[model samples]
Target: MQNPASANANVTVTVTATATVSDFAELPATASHGPLRIEYRWVNERAGDAPIAVFLHEGLGSIAMWRDWPQTLCERLGMRGLVYSRPGYGLSTPRPHAQKWPADFMTAQACDILPALLDALSIDRDERGRMWVIGHSDGGSIALLYAALHPEALAGAVAIAPHVFVEDISVESIAQTKQLYETTDLRSKLSRYHADVDSAFYGWNDIWLDPAFRQWSIAGEIASIRQPLLAVQGHDDNYGTMAQIDTIAARVPHAQLVKLDACGHSPHRDAPEALNEAIAAFVLKISAS
Candidate 1:
């Protein structure tokens, strides 16, 4: 892995003209189990009268990793955007070395951390009309879980490449990644965005590889998500298959599906314009309805 100093030295952040908000900011956070400071950013310049949209990054995502997409989307949709690094990712604190995350780490993120994050920012249905979630990869799963658990709190959600169930392909991809981190320069590359690259990687990688995780499915939870939703996936995505979005659509007939051609796991990175346009249109349509 790249040394911490080298990684820190290579860090660069960019905010685009399309972004409604820019610059790093702080939030007053109180963790459920510890006293670590949790910081967050908001893109609200164009939030005119629309509901707030929270952007949840992928398993390997960080606020910086998102570049300026959050701002762009927030501006395009005339909505507020919230972006933060979950514990152990990005500028957030590393996970406690002693304990392995529970099998339901995704569940805890949806049930616990998200709520706390909203509370820390003083956001809710009352203030933001109804909460809207835009999550990618792991964040997508958390979004689905949040919408499932708190349907009343959301207007709708957009899940980009979310995992609803475990597949051999997903596990195999993760296993390959584990190897890359160990044998290649992948860890060094990752260190640029992570305080503790192993903590961030293993926390996600280990749990997903656990035997018990094979049964980690959220397809059953879709029935409870009464809110409108948009599920987008790329055809070329190697990490997950169409089954992820298909299951949600099958369960919730009203759910909209968008399968992009030639795109990979990171739609925002691989096809930012298309992703942003689709997202902006979807959010507008749902909010107007």
Candidate 2:
């Protein structure tokens, strides 16, 4: 494998025109909850038989927030891409006001919702082989859980700013964001991306702020993941420290680590060029082997 820092430093990110949303699909609730109308888009659909890259958004993120990063990365790798909005975010089904998400919400998403959505769309891993997963923040945690739970169903995983365990800084940052959401126009701004901005915001915020949630940890659970893993985080990330991906590297012996300079919690937004290059190289390296 090439040195991550050098590989990222050597590559240039080409600006590409934004891709349009392809379509939306609904998957009937396979579990106890309501049905979900997931908004998604496909990129490079003609990349026949190439491994697909599934992009998972962050806590406050949506399909629109991802913009054209997935398409850009897929085009670089000559691979297909799938980008989608989880329930209660983007154009997906909104959460009921009375419904309080459990601490295991991320687990349910990775094990249940993702599989159901993939089945609904006929992206069978058994037939098409394992696909790559690129997830950010909460979605990054979900990706780790998914890979640990279904090791055979994944080719590799790239987790950007994933949280294996909650930290004081995380809670503090979340609290600040909550305050901003309540006091500022954060809700209105988020509304442009989500069908029910409150649902999306509170669903994630409440769970993270819950006192019982401090004990939440996936460090033990992710040790079984045998796939090629790339864990990236920014040095200036306020929401989480390097310990997040560092723990992942310690657990998953073969996991590669990339610490970005002059970047923050969201490396994709702060350092898109370097992130794009790193991910493209990692994915390509794994695919070739």
Candidate 3:
């Protein structure tokens, strides 16, 4: 267990072994958004025939940010798992300052980019049937949105501390993070993993804090997600409130909400044992059905 002191009184204690690149299959990904070339890495290696589980990282997350959770859970469940960095995070392409993400950036990812990436790797969504998605923070919201938009493309989804709508608290927290990134060495530290950390950080932070983004809420989309769903939240998340998961439960009929005590925004990082156990059981139940 690693306990890190934070500006917030609620400190974050993370428990899990960090995995190296060797633990994953670093497959190169290629896609196109006009003339821009997008790059990504995929980790999907399992010994058995369990359902494929795709992992989406958080706002500041990458394949490295996920640590060993993917390998751990996939091994425990005898399932295949995939972890990849999005357009602006980790080793993926940096977001150009000259261009702005569309208002429906997340929608586009779920509707277009993600499918393109899957196709690039020859993972036939229609033939493989439906793959399970395990997403954290912003990635979690993306997963939920993807399930909602393409209900037939997913077997189920698990979201951890997902953001559905912008809140005053979220904006305030991000403002503090901006200060940390600039004044402190947070940006430098992140640079070790990301080639252009600022691009990744500001790209995500700025768009989320935009005034118009407050109107960005996918709770309405949740009503359309018919697949079995699991929403997990930590009691001590500094990013967003529990309402994120509550809204999901209110909309999706088969949604299961797991609230962990003494946990934070990233449940797989803060409580890996509990998370792995829950995911294994949930996957088993789904497979049985």
Candidate 4:
């Protein structure tokens, strides 16, 4: 549990995902992950008339880990923004050391926790209809799942390096990362962002390396997303191949694809200009339609 003194009292949640459309409303809003006190921040918070951009971070990411990218992109798109650290990462509740994430963990996040946060913030149905979801890596996968589950809720989504299915290469890279995390200064570096760095790191790291997690995939699931989606990837990405976005474009036929040259798993960091331009154009086109 986080010391209440440091967390945002306005955002601490006591309600379950059962919040409704009238004011607020599951992995169905009903699948409870129990109580979570999330850590979040608002960008352009006074821009009441503009649409909201909800950002979900990568597997090992926290709000601070996202740096200034969310604020920059939301500004370019003329939108307000919400960025938060999920439970078990950053200042949010830490994952119990004994807990091993189930295969449907990402699904649970999309359906259960994210909605609860939106509700906790008093972002009702109408706001959600005009909202955009932007996420990276595992966060990207959660964004896709949220759109699929609540097809009527979002304006669209920008998924950067999202995984729809597990690949041999992904498992291989994660395996290598485990080695690096132990042998290098990775833990020291990541500790700057997370209160319980081990909770954030090991919770994410242990799951991907688990043999059973190899079969985890949302490939068939994302096919249900009805909104416009832009899938971006770097040709040189070490974590996943272009097949991640390609699969999204194929499954969600209207989904646009942007494969960046000389980029890696994190486009916002590697190619900010190109990524910002692509997302701005996509949001503009969708908003006008």
**CA-lDDT, candidates in order:** 0.77, 0.82, 0.73, 0.82
Q: Which TM-score value belongs to model 2? A: 0.90
**Candidate 3 residue pairs that clash:** none
Measured over all alpha carbons after superposition, the RMSD of each candidate to the real structure, in angstroms, is: 6.2, 8.3, 8.7, 6.7
Write the residue-wise lDDT of candidate 1 on 163-186 in tens digits.
999989899999999999899999
lDDT by residue for model 2 (216-260), tens: 999999999998999999999998999999899899999999999
Model 3 — TM-score against the truth?
0.86
Off by over 4 Å in 4: 1-32
Writing each residue's lDDT as its tens digit, candidate 3 over 1-289 gives 0001111122222213322342111223335364323333444453545567888888888766776778878788776876777777665667887666655778767776666666655677563465888888888988988888877778888888898887787888888888898999898777765557777888887887678878888888879988888899889998888888888888886799889888987788788888877877887898788
TM-score of each: 0.87, 0.90, 0.86, 0.89
Which of the two, 1 or 2, has more lDDT? 2
Ranking of all candidate structures by their lDDT, best first: 2, 4, 1, 3
Task: Flag regions of model 1 displaced more than 4 Å.
Answer: 1-32, 46-49
lDDT at residue 267 of model 4 (Cα atoms): 94
What lDDT does candidate 3 reach at residue 247? 85
Query: Which digits, one per residue and each the tens of the lDDT, describe model 4 over residues 1-289?
Result: 0111123334333212221111111112144555566778888766777999999899999777788899898888889998888888877778888987787888888987887778777788899999999989999999999999999999999899988888888888888877888999987887777778888888888888888988887999999999999999999988899888888887899999999999988899999999999999988988888
Model 4, position 164: C-alpha lDDT score: 85
